[model samples]
Target: MKKTFVKIGLLLAVFGLLVGCDNSSSEVVPPSSTSEEVVSSSEEEVKLTEQEYQIAVNYIVRSVPLVLERGVKVPTNVERAEAENPLPTPELKYGDNLLLITAGELKYEDEINGVYLYPEYTVTYSFLEQEPYAGFTFEYDDIGRYFAVPEYPRYEAEYDNGGNPIHTVPPAKAARLYVTIHIEERFTTFNMDMILEPQAIIHDYNLADVRSVPTGSVVRVYGYFNGYFSDWNNGVLCDGDVALGLFKLQEFNHMELGKMYAVVGQFTVYNGLPQLQWIKTVSEVEPADHPTVKEPKAVVVSADDFADQLDIGNELSGPLMHKVGTTVVLNFPLRYKAMLDRDGNAVEPGALELGKHADVVLTGKDSDNFEFEVKLSLNYHMGTDNQAAFRDFFVTNADADIYFTGPLGAYNAINLAPFAFEGTLSLTPPVVS
Candidate 1:
């Protein structure tokens, strides 16, 4: 069947930051229900009237695509910062410390400096411990010439008017935050190269409404839920903007750029230039919060995973069974097997293993879920007969109750050749109606 499924999103910021997002809620599904007079796809002959064939075929065509569109989501958060007295102001310009972060630990490469945080929290400023203890190390130097602190002499010249000891310098301040967030909507498209950069912010109020907020000043944005102030060129983001003219923030050095970011510096109109600085903890930034998983539901659908490419969303809802070594003697008509292998073949010992990309799915009455999977195989009788006799030998639930009632000859056309299918099928994880 021709089905479609996927969700993705993207946005760019100043300094060439790029953000892409994706989330899916799908997994392996199984089958559970059965029909009253439905023709099971067993290798037996089923006498179907014209009306019954149409009803079953219509159901299979509409359900599979929905599975792919619903995808799964997982959570991840990471942070890091340097520790120094009156410490260091993280900057991108030369001679400053380069900060690198992951799930844990902060490495001040330039200073051969390494400091561990509160295990779950991180610090970014150059501050002094409020209550210094014996187990903790705290010391100062008299001839301090490095760092962003004041340079003082070891001793004062002895004079009647100025023989005094110099006062000690204070420590700097820094902090880090941890949080969790939800991955909202996901959309995917190929030609989005122009959606780069949310920089070059220009705010303006209409001449008719001067009471409205101005265009280029910092402000908080709020919706029915809530909102926050956003900064350009300061995220592990790539968004094309005016202020971050040629800085390639989209450049990924270690891992993917999607994993790195910075929020520091000032927002100013440098000459005729207008832009926000690369944010470096304007405040202790908190991470997004974790989300909760929903309660489970029933599943009336399932699939046989013979091939790795088997997608569970596109199957019909009902009981599914598989038998390989012999001709199937249940549900379907005996003629169906003969038609499947015109030469009257038996099972090939243990040759009925699932393949790489074949699968079978049975849905509920409304394709709301899956049930179980029967793993078996059958012989393919394509080139055996002088005429193409076994060409119609596949699986389907379409030929049920084919006589004079409503949908008397309707049948599902969703079929897969065992020679082409693969699986010791299972149908429990996906939809549960």
Candidate 2:
């Protein structure tokens, strides 16, 4: 009985807020599962009024369309990222950066808080112009569609009249708010430059992003970069929501950090701040089989982190290994990649791409620690549509070098991100460990 009333109250509150703006200290809508909706979250717990709930539902419906567009679709199905495919090469600008993240393995984490939150994220960056020595931290736009709590009532009170409280509930009964993100600041520096040298020191903070920040790099990334944020230390970037100032880089081939990117052009201090004019681009991708480097470094995620299923929000990491034999294999086949379709013949990955995305695949031997096949398929993802419906994108039938027969469980799982770029090369001697 009590539970039912609380739910009803929540609905009413949410609806009310939806009808009229809450005018609370809200910056942005959370990361909508669908693209068009404005999903925001509040740290406090509150029972949404019906008005707020109605607002939420409508927002959700609208948000869903943003992630899925009739305009552009990936092999998976990302609405906002629908414009991912570009026919003619576009001029790279603040806006054109989106093209880089158009398809396949097009996402990465910027290390917020203590973990790698959001599989799809913009690279963390800072300029010699910024004040803080540390680069920057990032957070999701509250993809859960959570709203800021309007301040929880001291007690969940219910009254038939306008006089006294007839019944009450605890804070636990109120809606629970969540802040989903982790941050990690690298001890790197960015030098001022007009030419964006992919290998510049400042680029070091987000070497992962800049390295894969070009079109056709085959790397996919989610989220956006900070423009001019106010609170640099608190871990948030870009103050207001109006500028819509975010550089979403999705498509770049993976590679080693410093070696993959270089600094270009000239940087100057404008009124005590660093300013950049023309960050140049490099043409070549880090060779898949680069000499002198290792192949297939492993990044393990405990089964617990993914909740038995991989999710877009949350930080994840572990040991990295170069040899396939050292990788941790999972008991179940990961649906992250694709194989011969139900039809049998090799299904063109682009055909399977229902959304804006590319595929990440590997060709090698199963390691001793995590024995498996060296199958080729997609791994990472980057798009505006980050949510539950994405499960359909994974495949389980690719031909791997080795096959598993028993229930190895999550312990068998391994992450191949560290080795996506630069393969072990015959020409380059392996550096002595």
Candidate 3:
């Protein structure tokens, strides 16, 4: 049996200011006479009055967790494993009726394959007692299910400096929304009609917290735009303690390096490192509130030590993996193998290939003479025209000591992709016998 989990949102608009109330009751009460209008003898033939609708909305609002709140703290690997194989609950078994409601501000909407697709919503909710903002995606269809569009009365939305819409709804007006869902095989199929609302609220997060969650989670983080790799179409965001890569930015052209900015995007991971992708917005933050930006110091390590850190079985768990997105100064003896281009084709001796990636393979050995291979990615974006120069020098001096400094990166095995070595690549010729 196939199981799908369908998420739905119910945005409530009340005439008066809605106050938070305690909702600890386990049972849902049927509407009373004052809240219900009976037009027929059957229980299903009754209509809900305004008062009854408000009651239902309130109950749902309290029952469903907010999206943002759930993202604050993600479950650990062990916890995730336990969740995947949980003890069955006696009360909520397969095929039992369930109501899953969530509230959030709409992020964006788009049609997939010419079919109406649901939008991802940003909301705040408490998970395991911690409140964090998270992005939630709901699934819906056009037929066989019932949904009511949420109405916002007299609210005008304006654009922020970043060109994102800002929704400012008065506290007095609210709307009632309804959705009917059916659950089978742990999946949900529902019908819905919704209008995409611009995200009004974005939560602030630190780099550490953002790195803690799984990829594809939406998050808003504030940091300094320290560096960029135009070739890779990404940049780097750094706080004092941690740095993260920013990918698929929508407004990279206007981003000024060394400026503090708040960015909202989906969390992503590449080659065991955390990154932010599909950026929704980028706004400059006031300097007064943010700390002065500082360049991250590179961790010095030997080529052999770097290789040991590249534990394929235990990614992001090793000591070096923790520093994946940061800079590193590598010191090793260069035992030249071959200089290749992006397509793994070896560059002829003394050939200069401009504006392309250079993949240099070298043999690294430890004090015990343990041998390992390391690939270094270089060229165009690294701030120099040293691709041919380095290749020429290394070809002549096959055995030399080298000090290479660049943004520490890894792929499959440990290799630097998109690294810069302006004055960072230094070589010492072998001493005469």
Candidate 4:
């Protein structure tokens, strides 16, 4: 399944550049040598459940481009359907809403084989609440197999009470959705691009509707490069000290620190976060005088919530999954003085390191006083400057409000320990016990 997904991703990237090509012979494989030439008596029609039917519809919708690549006109059913609900319109944006095709609305018209099936469906580009499995299985019953297209939500938009826009895109511009489809038995796949148009472009969002826009949709955002995430090949853009979005580019080697700039790109969601990719650099501007740093959301959970922590598989599927790689404030007080050099000893705020750097354990209780624990580490050995700054901030234990700020990192299954990002540090001074 992983290999299949990789092929699908690669195929989409290639299809985006190569519009018309008959490279299907190398990519697609027939079920059997003789099956491609003739259908066997074992062929059967498999009735599909509602969910399965929807998946089949999505598979076909995603296959339109592949069919076109074969130099064949799109199926009349598909072209007609698309004509009725064309994307990139002035009302709705693709990925913003569902395109419902009731039962019998879509009929499979096999021009070559003359096979057919009527299926019901509901397809959307909205962000799914729960992450889907990395792999999927397709069911087959001879003739042609039905495959499920993996759904990856580009972004989840946040809105205001009156249904007005906030930090996301306004109602006027719709998002564009690019889809990649993979077939199982006859190992075939293709790609398609869909765009939904907004009714009107209203200047209503606080941050110019940058973060809420969809992938492949152009946007211009105003922000400053606060830091860089080398792993993802993106530069952290922030409203001030707070991370607002990511600038998707190969490197931020030439980016100036503390200077404001207007970044233009197609907004996308990567690893469950908002980002701007295919970046277009605009001119730089002066930094904001009094930009407020929007604090991370406070999450209150108990020890019981992480009781079965040693299970690495469940760790991500568990309660802390959403908090992974996100800036969050664990709203619980620390029960151990583990950040200090000596046990039970308190160090000054700016004290130097004692050479012994290790994982620090933080234990605390929720509002009900139920205990929970989290592990933190400072492994920033990239450069002396980063190491020195981290050592100075973490080595000493001073009395002040403690706030965990940075991405949540590795997890110790044996000890049920979840490691905080290397950059994780107390936002304020730690309270001396």
Candidate 3: C-alpha lDDT: 0.48
lDDT values, one for every candidate: 0.19, 0.23, 0.48, 0.38
Residues 238-266 of candidate 4: C-alpha lDDT, one tens digit per residue = 55223444445564467764566666555
TM-score of each: 0.15, 0.18, 0.49, 0.32
Whose TM-score is greatest here? 3
Candidate 1 — which residues are off by over 4 angstroms? 1-296, 300-349, 352-355, 360-433
Winner on TM-score between 1 and 4 is 4
Q: Which ten residues in a row have the lowest lDDT in candidate 4?
A: 1-10
Candidate 2 lDDT, 1-433, residue by residue in tens:
0011101000100100011122242422244311121122333334444443433333332222211111232221112124466232111111101111110111122356332211111111122213222111222222322122222223322333222335543321112111111111111111111111111112221222222232212121111222211111100011111001111112222222223222232222222222222223322324342332232232233324323222221112222111112223332233223333323355554455433323233323222334222233122232223211222323223333222211011112322321122231122222322
- lDDT winner between candidates 1 and 4: 4
How do the residues 1-433 of candidate 3 rate in per-residue lDDT, one tens digit apiece? 1122333444221111122322232211122201111121222223333443334433333333322111222222222234657422111111111122333322222245332212222122211111221112222334322122222223433444344545565442222212221111111111111122333344467877777765555568887776676666787777653677788764666887668888887776676667777777787877666565444646666656776765562134445644554666666665777788778898765674766777787777777787777777764766445655666666776767665666655455556543444555667532322
Give each prediction's root-mean-square deviation over alpha carbons. Answer: 35.4, 29.3, 20.6, 22.1
Per-prediction backbone clash count: 107, 123, 13, 12
Q: How displaced is residue 117 in candidate 1, in Å?
A: 23
The deviation in Å at residue 287 for candidate 1 is: 14
Name the weakest run of 10 consecutive residues (lDDT summed) in model 1: 402-411
How does model 2 fare in lDDT? 0.23
Candidate 4: misplaced stretches above 4 Å? Answer: 1-208, 240-242, 287-332, 335-363, 373-382, 385-433
Ranking by lDDT: 3, 4, 2, 1
Alpha carbon lDDT of residue 257, candidate 2? 27
lDDT (C-alpha) at residue 84 in model 2 = 63
